[model samples]
Target chain A: MPGWLLWLTGYLVVRVRCAAPERFLNLALAQGLYFWDARWMGEEWLEIRIRAGDFRRLRPAARQARARVRIRRRVGLPFWWRALRRRPGLLWGVVSVVAAVYVWSCFVWSVEVAAPEGWQRLGPGDILAWAEENSLRPPVLRANLDANRLAEKLMLDRQELAWAGIRLAGTRVIIEVVERRFPDTATSTGPAHLVAERDAVVEEVTVIAGQARVKPGDTVRRGQILIAGIMLPEEGDQAQPGQGFSRPRLVSARGRVWGRVWYEAVGQAPLVEEERVPTGNQVREIKVIVAGREINVKPLRGIPYASFQEERWWWAWPVWRGFSLPLAVEAGTYREVEVRRHGRSLEQALDAARARVTAYLRVQIPAPAEILEEQVQVLPATPGQVRVRVTWQVRQNIATVFPLK
Target chain B: MAQGEKSSGGSKLRRVESSLVELLDLPADVVFDLPRLTVIGNRRVVVQNHRGIVAYTPRQVRVGATGGEVEITGEELQLEAILSEEVVVRGRIARINLRLT
Candidate 1:
């Protein structure tokens, strides 16, 4: 018989001791009893196995053969069931553990959101928040989730997402997303003109598919069309066949226009600067911040110096890379300093103000624009401040496509 | 005189039955109610159509068959299973003896 069937039916090993154990075996066989693995253990003792139900039948045969039968071991389901019944707590523990594992497997444990490569605007947290709103959050029952429907809804709700795939792997829910691809230029191919993005003096105009509106040395204002999409018939052209004078044709304007643009900025600095020079005496204090409130480890007395500067360094608990808990330890250092007023010469003040203006201009100018001319002017100084203004003339492409409504 | 006549008649009947079995190409063990022993590489033995186990020991095992007893002598011989019609013995079998009683 199969081992599993034997286990299910249950069996017992019995040791029979008698002067003639063979007689006991014959008597058991005669009684229609089934047994196996009968081995002689020396000194009139024999060990054999019989089904749990047939164990009692061996008693009559043992009596007829004058043998003493004692159960050596119990094997299979009946003994296990009896043992489990005797200890209700252990049985309950085993049952509860199995049930807990089954229940836990029914819910999602983790949620992962995967985005397209090089996509930076959308993050996993944003997708998770959106999923939470859609009832696809973690710890949700897997039975209630429809992967196809959820994926369809995600793509429909998020315009940037071109495709979405949601699947469950064990206890984790994985959401893969692809972002929509957009063309470099506007999708519309209708007639459009290249207009000046900002006010500039036109230096060169090259038209590829439209009529040139402005020539070299022409001054143009913002929104003025550099190349016109609508082209009229040339003066020498004549009507053909029955057609009247050729009508104007519309085409998408494409070309580059180089212009000289001017950029200007102004900066001011105080003539007499107030400076702080450290006095070398400093004190340190430690503080702990829970949530948004801080508690000092030791109370600090009144300030020792009238003029002082305090710098604090905070060490927060890092729960994850690039993320931290609100709890933190703050170390503050206070250095005593003396405030003094420093008088600057007129040339020095002008230089300081000019430096500030140059820094401001660097941020305003585009990288590819060539600087043709730069002029800095020192405005009339106010009573306690120096004022300077800087201007830059740069050559760059100033054309931008403006679709015709 | 009656006993002699009966013995002779039984021998004639046996001869006829054996001839009939041979003529039909029937299995002798099934037709003649004989024991069939299957030995596997001197490691295991299966006895079919056996009466019962007569004795069992680590070095020897005796099983009763239809008309004789099968004696198995080996080292650490074990009765793996025993049923009404089959008995399986497993061990390093050294010898087997079939004795008619």
Candidate 2:
């Protein structure tokens, strides 16, 4: 046996004989000494021996200390009995094995494949399953699905997609889409036979292309053929054989189809104004964010605004154990701005109205359309108020040409 | 022994003994008990620990002292006596002065 084993055996024999074993053990421990070879030998028995110097020190007190020590030792008997009966050493061995298996499975197992944008209307679950079947899941192939590439593929497949992109942060997948652009047929293809988009008298015809079928003074209805694309053979050429009677050719024609267009736009300015002054007040606040949600630091009271708008968005990140979150807040202040105005004469208001109407018409009509005439009439409603009506005639070449065979 | 003779003898002896005691207790350093008079020639007076006199009147007198020369209002007075310890003041028989304790 080892030297420590021999020593522990002797100590145990001495302890069994002593009346106060606790004191002896304490004295031995206090002397900066220990018996290293106290092996537990089956149930109800522990064998140990103390060092020679420790044994001498404990010898005098051993008889009295032994009894107390034995009582203390008996106090832990129930717990030790349960521990021995349960055999925790074996239980812990099994637990460690199970834990190792769990870790291995977690690191090695494959779940699902997910490509956010490429699959034509594929849902998240479908992509996950694909990833699993293909063994492209995380920690295996180490291939990350390119969201931008997926979005591009989707766009290429669908011509109607105006704008699209894919966002993949962590495991979540998001596909953003914008609708397609549709061209306005009337404006996109310029000059489609200006046959009166509205019905009116032909105030003027600035014929830029094709044969003029109607003059400025002629009255026309909606969808009336103002300029004819079909031309009849000349009288002198009628005798020629195999000469068709009529031929369709492309042509351009334009005329001002006037139909008493009336428009009313009103602008108002205040006669008096109120100003704002500092009230010398202040408030403090604290804000907290949790799980992509914000709890207000303080509630607002007596807020003076005719209208107010608020919008909120949360950003989150996935962690190994849980989620990391942050919140962004934007505040907007709304106040009334005062506008001052003074009374003006009818003639002056009329001139101002005319200038405004001219500017508006100039923006609406293209550069080629020239204003031929303008007339303004002012109807006074009150001493300082007047209603101004302005009428103008403009001429332009709005014609279309079609390919002829 | 006659009673009148005894009374004269006792009165004379008592007077002689009292005078002898007074003489023995008198201040030997003092030459005279006359008041040492100092006229400031102005209304205001200044004294330290002044005591034992009668009434004192302080008039509107601007007094200033600089470089050992004291001026009472505009009037200049030569310092007749100046002791590091105490000052004595005497003036015309207009008013008796009590020094401040």
Candidate 3:
């Protein structure tokens, strides 16, 4: 028989001590009792393994053969189960652990949010807070959550999101978001004039349905009209200077005009600045946290630094992706630091201020605009401070429609 | 004179039966009440159509057959399994002998 079958049915190792052990074995075999691994331990002693159920039948054979059969060891599953029955506490402990793990698996342990590239208006924290308000928080039962319906509701509520997808992965919830894209150009239906959006030197003009007021190389103010909605008659079509044959026609103006625009920004930096320098003295504390209660793992006195910077790391017991145990380890490190004034040269301060101005100007430029030239100027400022002004010249569309009253 | 005739007739019948078995191309062990022993590279021996275990020891094992006993002599011989009709012995088999009644 296979070893597994033997274990399942249980077996016993028996020692037969008699003058004629062969007679005993033959008698047992005649009675249809299965035995295996028969060995001679001595001249008059024999060791044999028999199925547990067949061991009881060996007594009559042993008596007839004038042999003594003593069980040397009890083996296999039945004996183990019998021992377990004697100690209920150990059995209950094993069962309790299995049940606890199964119960823990039925609830969500963590949640993750993924947003598309170039999207930052909504963060994971914001989405989690929204889910908390909607009763979809972590540690909730998996059966109670409807991922598809929740995703649909999220898309309906957040106008900025074009699409939302929620997925339940074991003990974790994953949410993916895509932001809505709006068209850049907006159209006006009524009659309007295309005017300069900012003060710039006109570079070129293409008129589609209007008369061009400014040409290339012309300087225009912010409100100056680049294309007029009213078009006068051609020179040949006019009757005379005082008496006009044809009247001016009013129509919506549609055109694109390019211009060179300049932007200026100011930045200041102090020559002497306060800096915090670490003294190389650091203290660390580690603790194990279970259910929000912490037990210190490292023995240490209270932190000694009056002025220190602290960095902390928390790690939870991760079972798998989207699954974790409630047990966590938290480690905190505190580094002592002292504040001191650092001095820099005037030239260095000026360079620092200029970098600040450049960074500020980058944010103000539009995506479609192309930078053509740059200029920087140092200005007089208060003592111990440097002030720098930066300018950028960019080429972009300057035409914006203004409705006619 | 009658006993001599009866012995001769019995011998003739036995010879006829053996001939018929050979002509029909049947296995001899099955046609006649016999035991078949399979030996595997001097490592183990399996006896089929066994009557019972006659004697067993670490170095030797004897199993009863239809008309004789099959004896196995080896070192550290073990009766891996035993039943009324089959017996399996595993060891470094040095010799095997069939003693007829």
Candidate 4:
């Protein structure tokens, strides 16, 4: 018979309670009796089993023991009985049966795995049964299979994987992967020439590796080569071996090749300005998206000065039986500020436009770029409004292409 | 005694008694001076001396005859008139009599 069944039968036989438990004491002592494994039930409780035959003999022994014991009376029979019932030896038989079943059920019944780290190769479904066999809880699985950690582990283990992560949903585990993106370095090994992006006079040239095609103070058109990476055969004997044959060579050249880029910008301000004040307006919205769906974070407020900026992040992976799970997030913020526009002279407006163009060119050109020439014109568009147009000629060394390796 | 002289003596005595009656009846106390002590109410009052021959019971009395009254309701009233138009009442005085001047 099962040890729990034997213990239950014995517990039914050797039941003993003091006539009046003194001080309502419930004495529980540890003993050597094993009908079920206690470790599987954790350390929070204890369990023990006793045989029915041994219990029948112990019953008489308990009666004799109770005769020698003295207990107080006025505490009530129910209290004393409960106190006596709580004794460890008495409850151990019942606890053993319950604990035995619990341990048996938890041994290898169900399993869940979670890895928050990316999964470069392995997924949660790949190890669900294994986790169940190991007696790991859902939370334990999630922590162990964290997507970011999983991705790191995968990257470390597999050279092909760039990154990986694992996620958990219900009993399912998801694995996400990111392939390594390699840059194109083949262009650096081939013969190619550097060409100007715009038509401008070559102000200066600095040769780094390849031969120079254009010199300073030379006017070059758009698409014209500024530096030559391919070399032609020199004047020599005809019909020579590879020595006399012309071939394209891979090389590099860098220089301060200046060119003028023209840009026309116009800025306008009304002669009569209307000041904006807070109108005490506000709006709120609630949004939800199902799978494979998207929603705008916030709609336009329709205010004159209202504008929006957006940032996006994407999370996608395979979970259990499903594939292509995507999670996208967009955040938006709204603010109210005062906006004022005042009339400016044609010259001042033109200068502002020129400054804007200069800033843009500075970002595009890493080296020093100066505005060599500017043309400004102002026309009265309305009775109270004037339109200003400014064209700027910015000179900068903008290499069309750089060597890749 | 002679008969004619006796009759004349009798007439003279009668005339004196008639004169006293006439004077007493024609408001004889009207011109007699009586010192006036006027107690108006619990708040304020005025006292004065008067040269009036007539005095009335329960009648108001005023030095300037300003229609103010002071009632005499006490016994054994005696008034000592001062030369400065001031009056002082003596004895168990309950109230003073006042009238127009």
Per-model TM values vs. the true structure: 0.51, 0.31, 0.45, 0.31
lDDT by residue (A139-237, candidate 1, tens digit) is 899999988789998876765666788888779999998865533334348889998978999998888989999999999999999998888788756
Task: Evaluate chain B of model 2: give its TM-score.
Answer: 0.22
Worst 10 residues of 1 chain A by lDDT: A179-188
Docking quality of model 2: it rates as incorrect
lDDT of each: 0.85, 0.43, 0.86, 0.47
Best by lDDT: 3
Q: What lDDT score is found at residue A44 in candidate 4?
A: 21
Among the candidates, what TM-score does chain A have in each?
0.47, 0.37, 0.44, 0.37
Is candidate 2 or 3 superior in DockQ? 3
Residues A67-129 of candidate 3: C-alpha lDDT, one tens digit per residue:
888999999999989999999998898899999999999999888888865464567777788
Candidate 3 stretches greater than 4 Å from native: A41-45, A110-138, A142-405, B1-14, B39-43, B73-75, B92-101
- Interface DockQ per candidate: 0.44, 0.00, 0.49, 0.00
TM-score of 2: 0.31
Candidate 2 chain A has its poorest 10 consecutive residues by lDDT at A67-76
Write model 2 residue lDDT over A107-186, tens digit each, in one string. 42433333423333334465454445544355532144655566676555444445556554434344555544332224
lDDT for each residue of candidate 1 in B1-101, tens digit (9 for 90 to 100): 99999978978998999899889999999987788999998999999988887887899999988778999999988888877778899999999999854
Worst 10 residues of 4 chain A by lDDT: A21-30
lDDT of 3 at B101: 50
**C-alpha displacement of A212 in model 1, angstroms?**
24
Docking class of 1: acceptable
- Runs with alpha carbons beyond 4 Å of true place in candidate 4: A1-189, A236-256, A260-264, A272-275, A279-364, A373-375, A379-385, A402-405, B1-101
- Per-residue lDDT, model 2, residue A247, is 51
Q: How well is candidate 4 docked (DockQ)?
A: 0.00
